[model samples]
Target: MDVNTRHVLIAGGGYVGMYAAFRLQKSLRKEIRRGEVTITVVEPRSYMTYQPFLPEAAAGNLEPRHVVVPLRRVLPDVQVITGRVVGIDHAEHTARIDPRDGAAYDVHYDELVVALGSVARTLPIPGLAERAIGFKQVEEAIQLRNHVLDRLDVAESTTNEETRRRALSFVFVGGGYAGVEALAELEDMARYACRYYRNFRAEDMRWVLVEAAGRILPEVGEDMGRYTVERLRKRHIDVKLNTMLESCVDGHVELSDGTRLDSDTIVWTAGVKANPVLAESDLPRDDKGRLPTEPDLRVVGAEHVWAAGDCAAVPDLTGPPNAVCSPSAQHAVRQAKVLGDNVARALKGRLLQNYEHKHVGSVASLGLHKGVAQVYGIKLRGWPAWFMHRTYHVSRMPTLNRKVRIVADWTLGLFFPREIVSLGSLQRPREEFERSALPRQFSPPASRSPELESAHAGGRPEQDGK
Candidate 1:
């Protein structure tokens, strides 16, 4: 392999991909400058979302844009392609790229990093796909915020009790950090928004968290989980444990515990599975559909291919003998550093290092000035945990510019009330315009031209024949 002019193609622009490219660009600065190495990153979005702040974004505590790092702006030295990798031919070291509505093309690479992060793992729940929304991206977060506020608007405008109740009811599935934080933050926002509505009170809103498991926040331990449940219960939010959503047909929720709820909004945050693009590739994946990787983050049995983050089943040397790394922002960020260095080492013909980081504790923000955290075996709750959650995540969010912007948002939020204006029209932006431009029968009658009026009357206007 030629040391000069070697191309490194990275799939997915999530935390792992972005960090890996960021590190590689810095580590291989000389090679990049000398035209010895080229780093290319392909992803559907132009920005990398810092998912830790997604809950806050939904709660109006953080700007949606500030929670995402623009890939091109952050990695100017790297080639950032706004496209999706449809297939990966490992044997040929080529990737099939679809530039989103454009013709597909293939790109060759000497080294390939498969960081295609996981997508929301969904089950065949009735009415799930159509009625429920997933809390995964910035768009979803923004949409959910608007949706919650829109529901409040509906409830306030409706006179029917059932309609009002349904509009104010929200059901959230999954008990993990994503589910818990999202529920707590949104509940807080809804409660605050109630102050603006004369008919809607904080108690009028029904926030239900249903987890199939016995407890929530399993990462923070059973103690914290129990405390979180209690705290939520105190806030009048229903915490249903060991509960399965039997069906959510048309937003009418049926639970395994024989309880039925009429909710307009259902947020699904259950879990995630590896990106299915791995199946399309010739890469070796494990039973769970994640790429089986060595401790150095290299794909097992593939010399030039590497994998990391949620899509890779990396052996956990720091834990039990057969344990694999869990999918989390903490692990992904740490793994990217090691993976990036190893890729640089491979290109320069140097010895590679192993990735053996132990699982640090977790922090979860419950709401404004409220949270629970377990860091370095120490447990904290309430204001301390909330402060820690914000501090840790902001420090980790990519780019100093983003960090400052987020902090500024928080600082401003201290003095200002939460913005509850519902921009739900954004979801179907052209609806109003389309409705207005509908057929004449559907639209209101308007003054017509004299010729058009004459034609409509089924007669010609009087004309002189000379």
Candidate 2:
């Protein structure tokens, strides 16, 4: 092993990957500048999403771009590859990189960081793959915002009772932070947007939150969870506990308790499982497809390899016996700092430290000026809780630049109102261009030239059958 040269290849530029690499490059600046050490990060997207703000982003409280930190911009000293690591051969220290185009290539490394993070945990319910949307990324968040507002557009225009009902109905599965926050924020936004619509009213829109478990936000303990339920119910948001989505075939949602709903917007935030890419890796993984890692964030029984974030089953030192860390943002960011430091310590043959942090309580924002939180055993709800939620998350928004921008957005929102434009066309940006790109001979009748329109309508004198 050459001590003079080292290359660290980090897979999945999420919380763990980006932070770990950033730490390495920053800590080993001289080594990197001397060309003795190198760091490379490969991920599908070029940014790391500060997921906590995604709800606000979706609800128009925050801009979509502010939620994501550009991996290349943040980790300027490190190499950032925009691609996917399809396979990892830890023993050989090579990972198969699949770019957007061209053949898959291999990148050799001195150390491997498996930080692929988690993917949406989807069930095999009918129509789930097609109709159900996720709330994991900024793209999905904004898409949901556009989609929910578009549904409002659909409901306001259609006179068909069934169509209007379906368009106005929204069903959200799962009741964790993601599910609750997204449902609350979007419902608030939609209700606010309705003040401008003639046919829209708070009573007309039906919002339902379904949770398979008997309680929602189980992390916040039973009492706070109940309070959350009560608050939601008061807002006319139906909170259904002990229920499962049995089937959702063709927008007809069937609950386990035999309830049915016709909902055009079905957002799925049930849970998250380990990234499936770990299945292709040569590293040791648990039955749940997560890397089995020690408290030090090193993968068990694997040399030159480490893992963290949602994809690693890191032993919880601060919890009870035989306990493991829960896959939460709190743990991911903290574990990342330790993971990076431990990796740096390893290069210098120094002793490694175990990652341990007591589980602080949780915080969740229901909507603007509304939230619930349990911090340091003290329970808080409504405005103070919402304030804490925003404060904590903004302070943890990675770079100071993003934090400032987010605060600016909130400050601006204080005096001004949120823009409720759908921008659904942003999804299909080429539609107008594509329409114009069509030749006159191939254009639609309404958009065709006058002569072409007459010809297309069979009104030409030569084509007349008289």
Query: What would the per-residue lDDT of candidate 2 be over residues 19-60, giving only the tens digit for each residue?
Result: 899888877888888888889999999999989999999999
For model 1, how big is the CA root-mean-square deviation? 5.5
Computed on alpha carbons, the lDDT of every model, listed in order, comes to: 0.94, 0.92
| Model 2 clashing residue pairs (backbone) | none
lDDT digits (tens) for residues 1-466 of candidate 1: 3545999999999999999999999999999988999999999999999999999999999999999999999898999999999999989989999996779999999999999999999999999998999999999999999999999999999889999999999999999999999999999999988988987788988999999999999999999999999999999999999999889989999999998989999999998999999999888989999999999998999879999999999999989888999999999999999999999999999999999988889999999999999999999999999999999999899888999999999999989888889999999999999988887654325876776778777978666782
Candidate 1 lDDT at 128 equals 94
Where does model 2 exceed 4 Å of error?
1-4, 439-466
Give the range of the ten consecutive residues with the poorest summed lDDT in model 2. Answer: 441-450
What's the TM-score of each model vs. the native?
0.93, 0.93
